[model samples]
Target: MIKHIVMWKLKNPGDAAKFKAQLDSCKGLVPGMREFEAAVRTEGLEANVDVVLVSAFDDRAALQAYLEHPVHVEVSGVLGGLRESRTVLDYET
Candidate 1:
């Protein structure tokens, strides 16, 4: 299994709600994705990242498919404008 995790630091955490809705649109849209989740940091948590996406796939190819999907492309378009910084990690178990 592979886990693909991404964190985004937005220009404003208040604006992140829009990005959350965009990400929710991708639920069950990506091929070969076993699981998908998105969330934002809570108040008083000292969050360095504003949004986080955690996804699971059978392999790297599955992750790649998700990355190349049209739905994801649209999501990226929205996120790109909102993000100030981003971080990502992919690992297998």
Candidate 2:
């Protein structure tokens, strides 16, 4: 399986919830999506990132399909202006 993880630091921390919700809207967008989860930072945590996503796919092709899907493109559009910084990791497991 392929695991795709991403963390984002928002331009406005208050928008974290909205960003996470937008990401959640992409769940089940394509076949071979094993798992999808999005969450905002904890209230009193010493974290710098505002939002995080942890998703798993059957393989690289499945992961690619999800990235190229229109639903994901829309989510990316919403995140583009709101995020100050973003980091991503993908690996086979």
Candidate 3:
């Protein structure tokens, strides 16, 4: 299995909820998407990042398919402008 994890620091922290909602729209959009989750940092937490995504795929190919899917592409466009910084980690499990 492949795990894809990402963290984002938004230009405006207030936009976290909106960004998470937009990201949630991409769930189940493609095959082999075993798990998909997005969350914002809890209130009063000493965290720099605003949003995080934790997802699982069958393999690298499955992860690639999700990245290239139209829904994901559209979601990325929206996220691109809202985020100031982003980080990602992918690994087999």
Candidate 4:
């Protein structure tokens, strides 16, 4: 399996709710997602990223398919507007 993890820092910290909603929306749109979770730093911890996304896929190809999917593209479009910085990691189990 492949685990795709991502973190994002929003342009406006106050938009946390909106960003999290977008994350859930994106997850709902993904067809082959084996698992998906979104989290926000509720503890007000000092961190560069405001939100985190942890997703699981069957393999690299499935992960790639999700990345190329149109729904994901649309989600990214929304995220691009709201995010100030982003980082990602993909690995296999």
lDDT of 3 by residue, 28-75 (tens): 987899999999999887887899999999989989999999989999
For all candidates in order, the CA lDDT equals: 0.87, 0.94, 0.94, 0.85
- Counting clashing residue pairs in each candidate, in order, gives 0, 0, 0, 0
Ranking by lDDT: 3, 2, 1, 4
The C-alpha stretches of model 3 lying farther than 4 A from their native spots are: none
Q: Tens digit of lDDT per residue, candidate 1, span 9-40?
A: 99987987888888888878756789899998
Q: How do all models score by TM-score? A: 0.92, 0.96, 0.96, 0.88
Flag regions of model 2 displaced more than 4 Å.
none
Residue 63's lDDT in candidate 3: 94
Off by over 4 Å in 1: none
Worst 10 residues of 4 by lDDT: 24-33
* Full-model lDDT, candidate 1: 0.87
Candidate 2 residue pairs in backbone clash = none
Report the CA-based lDDT of candidate 3 relative to the real structure.
0.94
In candidate 2, what are the lDDT values of residues 1-93, reduced to their tens digit?
999999999999999988988999999999999999999999887887889999999999999999999989988997899999999999999
